[model samples]
Target chain A: MNAVADITQSRITRRFAKLKAEKRPGFVAFVTANDPNPETFREIFHGLPQAGADVIEVGMPFSDPMADGPSIQASSQRSLKFNTSLKDVLAAVRDFRKLDQDTPIVLMGYYNPIYVMGPAKFAEQAAAAGADGVIVVDLPPEEAEELDVHLRANRLHFIFLTAPTSSDERLPAIIARASGFLYYVAVAGITGTKSAEEFAVKDAVARLRRHTSLPIAVGFGIRTPDAARTIAHHCEAAVVGSAIVDVIAQGLNQEGQPAPGLSQKVLGFAKSLADAVHAAQH
Target chain B: MSKVEPRNSFRQGVDENGHFGLFGGRYVAETLMPLILELDKAYEAAKADPKFQAELTDLHKHYAGRPSPLYFAARLTAHHGGAKIYLKREELNHTGSHKINNVLGQIMLALRMGKPRVIAETGAGQHGVATATACARFGLKCIVYMGAKDIERQKPNVFRMRLLGAEVRSVDKGTGTLKDAMNEAMRDWVANVDDTYYCIGTAAGPHPYPTMVRDFQKIIGEETRVQILEAEGRLPDTIVAAVGGGSNAIGIFHPFLDDASVKIYGVEAAGRGMNSTAHAASISGGSPGVLHGNRTYLLQDENGQITDAHSISAGLDYPGIGPEHAWLHQQGRVTYVPITDDEALASFHLCSKLEGILPALECAHALAYVDKIAPTLPKDHIIVLNLSGRGDKDVFTVAEAMGEKL
Candidate 1:
């Protein structure tokens, strides 16, 4: 596919290129949009870039997140209480774009919300709102054509997930339609549930690298800075989702309101992870 | 509109990509896709294997009590005073429900695939009990995920599953219903893909599952077809069954789909009413969306967030319907109607009083619809309703609904 050429000049492509030049692995921070509250989430979104997030994955909350573990599921529930819509998520990206044009933002969630909004409209709106890519946890390669076509036409990257269970015979089919990067799900389970062994992730990344030139980002279990540092040593980027979401969950008061300095506290955790990832060397 | 050429067969469906028109495709995470595809291949092989067929047939006859009598409900037929009603006695099957038919097939397939542990999700606990029983028979480990609220109301079935040597895990997330139980089950399958076979209760999940479950459960319709023809010398004028995830309904509906002369009706639970938000009527009240690994009619909000579904019957209280039901509904081959809680309760009592048989609340919804249309048809007209399960597990709920302490 011409997907690689299509996204050559995109924000995601540029960020990874810069990371390769610096000889440092990138750090991707994930947080549910409007989590805790819209205003607090906005502050966290704006602060992510300065806190050293090479790429940002803004979670679009849905009612049923089948692939998610307790942490991300709770995060989505908290975000939904504020009525976080896809439009609101896009608007967050748009606002973030005004302050920092270089940081790449990818919206991650299930397919039902995007399917409800209409695929073509979602792609157009996402591109227009300055989002660079999408990672639909439930939309595997087999069922991705409808949304992928629209994303390709909009010049936005459609990131596909490769799991530990994704066999070598299946890698070709998965990577054939992939763009931006391949997200190597470190664990065979749902998000935030189990940590991946560094050796296993290293081997899996090596196997994936032999097939494509796309940058690989490992996710699903890297929670602490040490784990992030070790995982980042193998892939182009290390992604931490539930870990940061857990920080936000912990920062919430008993009344379900964000305590004072919750945004700062979440950003602080992201900074520590980013520092560890950026410090990774070959 | 121009005259459309009628298709040769309505039974042919679900293209290789696991779609029924715009519905029913593999919409699971990448983690489960390879395993689901593997399952599809195993199922196809088993379908063509004479040994597998013989074994399933043997189990159905000797183990689960096959050919559950197609009882002629003479008293109810006279009470309706119009259509001669027949009840396909699936309730007489082992475990007191139609769930065993599909469980027997799937658990046998799990053995073939060498997956020793089996996991399942249930709202009414009928499917759990069936799976647990199968696991006990086969000596495979069994884990059943049940919603906390469902476990509370369905205490007897929960106890039955435990007695059958299954571990029951309570899921308290997302309104603590079937939807939540399904989510937990998927998580378990994802985490334990190597040895665990996810025995989905209904025909609603991803491909191979919808088709596989229907294939196993189609004995209901196959038997009904033969029994009705022998008794009435013709196919019934109409066939009615309740749809939750639509396993039982699809089982009976698939065999008669090609018969143009026969009419079909699928009932959905309208908890309070269709006008009110409380209901499990996906086709009648909701629209098409993807959930639980397949694209089907779902009770979702404008933002595509799934809404909680309500029904007096735990078995019928799910937010989505099987993709095949969505296809059949869209094709206009099967008419889907909503039956309210009060209507179902009345029928539940009426059928018991008239036929000396207590039908499941899920089946009562179908009887409620039959109660509406049967009286309007001629006495010579025949209508067959699937008695999908026995109501023994529902006595406490029914008594409470009747405001009785017992």
Candidate 2:
């Protein structure tokens, strides 16, 4: 993407466009930034796109991840134990830029740390550091002025999440300013829960489609390949977060330490999810 | 009493879109936006209707026992030998705390919204008991989320809630205290938004809750204003209340926000000490951040993960205060203090001995602040302290702390 014309277009938007051109659904992978340490985060950061991640979500760990389930919360704690601030998370993205620059990297977390860092500076820094988008779990459309204005000004996608509990009246405002794509949460509860039923995902995707032309990415469940494939059938992409974090968690030994080759375990999960998405795209 | 800012009202702050300066806003998930907006509308309508006000007043006067005595603390006043002390007797309320006032109002609004169930998060269990009592009286399904740590500390309260017919779920996440319990309650609300109404125990969460709970609890300040005039013929020189989620303090502070002469104090728990890692002093040492919805000052580490708040009093063990209070402190209209565990504990015994009143440890934080400042002020200076809850549930805790087996 060139700075003169394509700076306004995020890697996320480009990914969606590419998926549309190929007539295939996209595969999104997520892992907490610096979950164990910087070395471990770099492993997942580079491995994701290679293992078939169309978009990468790097979690900015917060102490209170209210919307996350046990697996993601534990992952956040692991990151925080090493004092992994937003600066480090951005630095990780900047580091990833040295090797590969095509895959979209979305910094996903609660709003506190970003608020602590100052929203304008955060937006500018994220853009400068080659980050593609931001998914602040706690910032709804109504209150996102704290970050949205700055992020939009920096030409970064302010990715918003929509749940089944969202009202019909709420959709217009939600998608009105959203760029890249909309993240459709398939479950009502926190992440790492059961996958949503197929018919329900179909209805929700159809409902979300009525409001925006932006590609809808389904997430928050669909841990297995079959579930990911099922969701990818109707949506433009499938995002898996907790399942990959769980793989990282399972790879860790007792006393809350990461076992060896944790990144490879995550890559294995990503390969399976990508294969499923590609199979369903046909 | 100089410095009267005329044309000022409690409503002067918190702009049209739910903000105290830049502090309070709906920083929740998109799923909760519609529900919060609907609640805002319902509350606005209900607040304007005379019928709703009349019913709330009736329930307050008869059921929950409104006008819970503004009593002159002659003993405390004599012992201090300085300012005349008065206690806003919230401890005398039906559920034994100021928590009932907000619960009664929120439960009414939940029913008005046609919600079938009510959910709440509690640390000391006083809010849980009050919620259960209200829901039982109204015949609504009540689910109170309590931290496992608090459940262990507050065994009697857990029994009281279950006996009063409320389901108490023990939450065991993130230090298993008020913050984690609130997170669990929020998750439940997100999952069951259609049928459940989340009755936040304090005035801290996203918009409308801080405003609504403060409005409901404003009776404390309103009553103190009228009652104190009857006893001493003017507003007290200062008003003090402990700041947990800042509900009681804001409740008392709101009505007097325009009264420039009336000094307001919100005493946050300092745990062992303010300099130590274990303290709940959000605005004092902690910087501003967002958690549990609203953007407020939070006790967090370098990484912005909310740290565990330390306090001897479970009620005052929260890491964040109400957004309005954060704004007030910034505006220099209210003074926020941090009281340590030893200080609050000493005041607990002092109040018990001096006035025959067993104040909740949370309220003792306020009382402790009063003890520090009351002796410094003149006898003409009157101070009103919120006795937010009784200490009956903390008998075992006190006994154990004193090196005696309960």
Q: What lDDT tens digits, residue by residue, belong to model 1 across residues B168-281?
A: 999999999999999999999999999999999999899989999999999999999999999989999999999999999999999999887889999999999999999999
Error of 1 at B270 (Å): 0.6
Query: What is candidate 2's TM-score against the reference?
Result: 0.96
Deviating ranges (above 4 Å) for candidate 1: A1-6, B1-5
Per-prediction DockQ scores? 0.89, 0.74
lDDT of 2 by residue, B325-381 (tens): 888888788999889999999999999999999999899899999999989999999
In the range A1-282, model 1's lDDT, one tens digit per residue, is 575576798999999999999999999999999998999999998999999999999999998999999999999999999878899889988888889999999999999999999999999999999999999989988899999999989999989999999999999999998889999999999999898899999999999998999999999999999999999999999999999999999988888988999999999999999999999985
Could you tell me every candidate's TM-score relative to the true structure?
0.99, 0.96
lDDT of each: 0.94, 0.89
In the predicted model 2, the residue pairs found to clash are A63-B305
